[model samples]
Target chain A: MVSILGVGLGVAALLVVQTVMNGFGEEHRLRIRESFGDCVVIAKSPIEGPDVLIARLKADPEVISASAYTEGPALARRGAFSGVAFVRGTDPLATDQPVRQYVVAGSFDGLDDGRVILGIGLARTLRVAVGDKIEVWSPVMAEQAEKGKAPLPASLEVCAIVRTGFTEVDDRAAIIPLRRFRELWSLGERAHGVTLRLKDPANAVATAARLNVGKAGLNFIPWQEIKKNFLEAIRFEKTMLFFLMFIITLVASFSIGSTLFSAVIRRTREVGVLVALGAQRWHLVGLFGVQGLLIGALGTALGFLLTWGILYFREGILDLINSLFGNGDMVANVYQFSKVPLHYDAMDFVVAAAFTLIVTTVAGLVPALWAAGRKPSEAMRDA
Target chain B: MPKVVLQATGLKKSFASPNGPLAVLRAVDLVVHAGESISIRGSSGSGKTTLLQLLGGLETPEGGEVFINQVEQGLVTPRKLLGHGVGFVFQNYQLMPELTALENVVLAAKIIGRSQVEGKARELLQLVGLGDRLRHLPSQLSGGECQRVAIARALINEPAVILADEPTGNLDETTGKEVMKLLLEVVAQRQTALVLVTHSREFAEKASRRLVLAGGVLSSA
Candidate 1:
């Protein structure tokens, strides 16, 4: 029973931790895809006709949607608040669907002349709201005209406030018309890149490989490849947690060995009887080994069931916990989301089960050997 | 010449005790011919049990050689020798409490690579008057019945030699005699060599050859 608990707890912890880790990675990747599309295509030199390339890519069945965008640093000043932000210039009609789907408030429109969209977080910090007038300055535009001069100022109206709920993107970002941004930056109808959405998010890599834009002179980057560091970190953390929790299972198996050893010592005569009846050492080994395996398997199964139960009602449980503790910021702290988002990975469950079985089998070794190594005469003498 | 089934020469054994190295057996020599039932009688401290242990390969002797079926004891690994065919029956009837009498006997046959283990175990159990109690475990059986199961287990592999150490010591006199009778009857059917250790003179007298251990030597009687 104790051995079962040990193995079960180990499997349970490994699965839970791995599932959460995978969920975290998947959630982040999804957000990146939704915000940046499945892949981004950038030109070696500013492509001459990016619209033509977009039309060609859109003709491909693999490509779901494509939109041209430009990005650069800009300073927005309003009263006492002045902060630098990444100003992304995107077409309100072409790029708004995939990128602005996560926008919690305000619509993406009104880009007729000097209108812009500001992230809610950035707007709050700048103490500005929709319809508020703000000054936009770019050093690149200033440098083009004369060196060491203050940036060229462009008076812009805050057309909308978009809340993406991502600190990295929402804290300091704004969107505007790609044409207006091109004119301001003096780029002359050139775009920084085009973001491509795929029919299947999982097929992003294959689709990236199939993207043949030889004449377009563009290089494509899959969203997964772009976030390789983050993905690797998540996988590494999950692996570390798996082994770390497996130690508990190993310790529990030791308890099983101890218990079996004691049982052998107490049942010396019984062992002698088997030996006397022509039972080989292997037979004794197998008998006790099977016992240990059963203990481990049972424990692992129980733990899996318990883990499933916990994961099944995780929302209610968390809510109950919140009711008691008065929710502070666990979701934001742990998952960087407003609530816990979980994904149950079957592969993680298999890994946990396999690891538990191995540990249990290994733990059975000492006891099995002890029982097998005893001489029938010695064992029977105890009778 | 008679076929020799078991032979031991100049056997010696000693164990470390708190006081000193206690000599259990010294220079013990014995032999048993095929199809012969020999009874070895000795007092409790006369190394009767130690000598039996060495003969059964349960303990290594300090000095001596043991041969079963003319195979050099040292040349054969103890485990392999046991698998080949060595049967032991303890006085206390050491049956596995978890296994039924039928399972206990069948397991022995299976380990020794005997085909039709279930059939053989059933036949042996019935011969020992345990046909009705085949499904009973050691815990469920009487002391005498448990001993009978142990006897059935010992014969499961059709071993060449049968060694019993005080086979009837744990039973009442009547039950002890009955067990002895059944043992002799089974051995006679197999025509195997039998070596029994007993304190009862009556039991010893039943054997074709009887040896009494005294003064560190077996004297024929």
Candidate 2:
């Protein structure tokens, strides 16, 4: 029973951690897709005839929508407060504008050449709200000033506020009309890039690769490539955790081996009797092997039941732990999630069960071999 | 004139001791026919048990061969020798403690790949006067009862010869007498050969042929 419980607890711990990690990964992916779309095509210089490129891209079967955009770093000042911000210029009237749904205050439709949308963190930093005026200077204006050609900073009204729930974007992003960006940068009828939303975001990498062919001076990047390091880190952590949790099952297997070894020693005489009664050596080995398999099967079954129970009562269990530790609302405060997330993948269960069963069965083989190695006469005389 | 059921020729066995190799059985020869009972008496440590083990093929003799039912024991597998050729009853009644009396008896049949022997096992238990204790485990049964279960287990496969090594050694006087009587009666009824090894003169005298083993040799008692 103890061995079974040990294996059960180990499996439950591994599965729970894996499921929660998957949930975090999924949530992060969703937020990233919301902010960056499925794929982005970037150019070294402003793209010429962007409308033609957008039309060509939209003609592809995989492309759901494509819109021209311009983005760069800028300095923003509001009264006595000032900060550096990433400025993105987009077509406000585009049907697939991703930031439109994230607008928390005011209206994205009001954005024009003289107005802009501020990310929630930037709005908080600047202490500004709707209808407030903010001064912004492009990097070109800074370069002109360095060359002794003084240029005035553009003054735009804050028409909306957006909170995309992605810390990197929400912290220091500002969106303005595309015409406003081109006018400020002294560019004519050009855009920095075009963002594409595909029919299946999971196919972004393949779509980006296909679209990059024959398109000179434009680099197509998928969301996965954009966040490769973060995703890989999550996967590495999950793998490490799986092996670490398997140690518990390994210890339990050792317990099973120990118990069977003791049984062999205790029943030395009985073993002799069985051998005298015509039992082959392999029969003794099989007896102990079957015992190990039974333990593994029962333990794995109990582990699955434990996993279901833990996931079902996850909220209450978290609440109890938090209350005991005096860390109320830990998930919300640390993870920015209102509740713990769990994602069930069938592969995780299968791998856990297979690993446990194989380890336990192999563990039993040691004692079984020892038992079968004894001579019947030696066993009887010794006992 | 009866058919020869078991034969051992020039049997020899030795053990390695701290001083030197000690010879146990030296040039021992024996033969027994069907429906015959032979008892070999010896002092403690006289290699009586060693001789029985060698004849039953439980121990490999260094310089002799055992034949059961006209087949040399060395030529065939030990499983065949112990399964269909001979049966063993140990001094301590070596029954599996976890198994019931009936299951222990049936286990011998199972070793020979005989599956449909539960009814025969029950009948053997009843013949040994253990019908009421068929469901009792080894730990629950008394010394004599455990010996009876062992005897029943030995006869389950109906081998041609039964090699009993002090089957009543652990029981009291009255229980030992009862167990010996039951063993002899059952072996006689089945017409199976029996090779009995004991230290008791009374039991040895009851066999058809009585012999005494000493100085690693067997002589008429």
For each of the candidates, what fraction of the native contacts does it recover?
A: 0.64, 0.75
Give the chain B TM-score for each candidate.
Answer: 0.91, 0.95
Per-residue alpha-carbon lDDT of model 1 for B1-221, expressed as tens digits? 66777788898888888999887777888887778899999988777777777777777788988777734442343335673546777787766778899998887777677777788789989999999999998899988899899888888876667888899999999999999998888887888778888899999999989998775567786
What lDDT score goes with residue A35 in model 2? Answer: 80
Model 2's DockQ?
0.75
lDDT of 1 by residue, A84-182 (tens): 878888887764455455455556656545888888778888899888978878766668658655555888888877755567677778888888888
Q: Compute the lDDT of residue A222 as modeled in candidate 2.
A: 96
lDDT of 2: 0.87
- For B98-169, candidate 2 gives per-residue lDDT tens digits of 899999999999987899999999999999999899999999999999999999999998888999999889
Q: State residue A143's C-alpha deviation in candidate 2, in Å.
A: 4.5
Measured over the true interface residues after superposition, the C-alpha RMSD of each candidate is 2.5, 1.0
Cα miss at B158, model 1 (Å)?
3.6
TM-score of 1: 0.84
Chain A TM-score, structure 1: 0.87
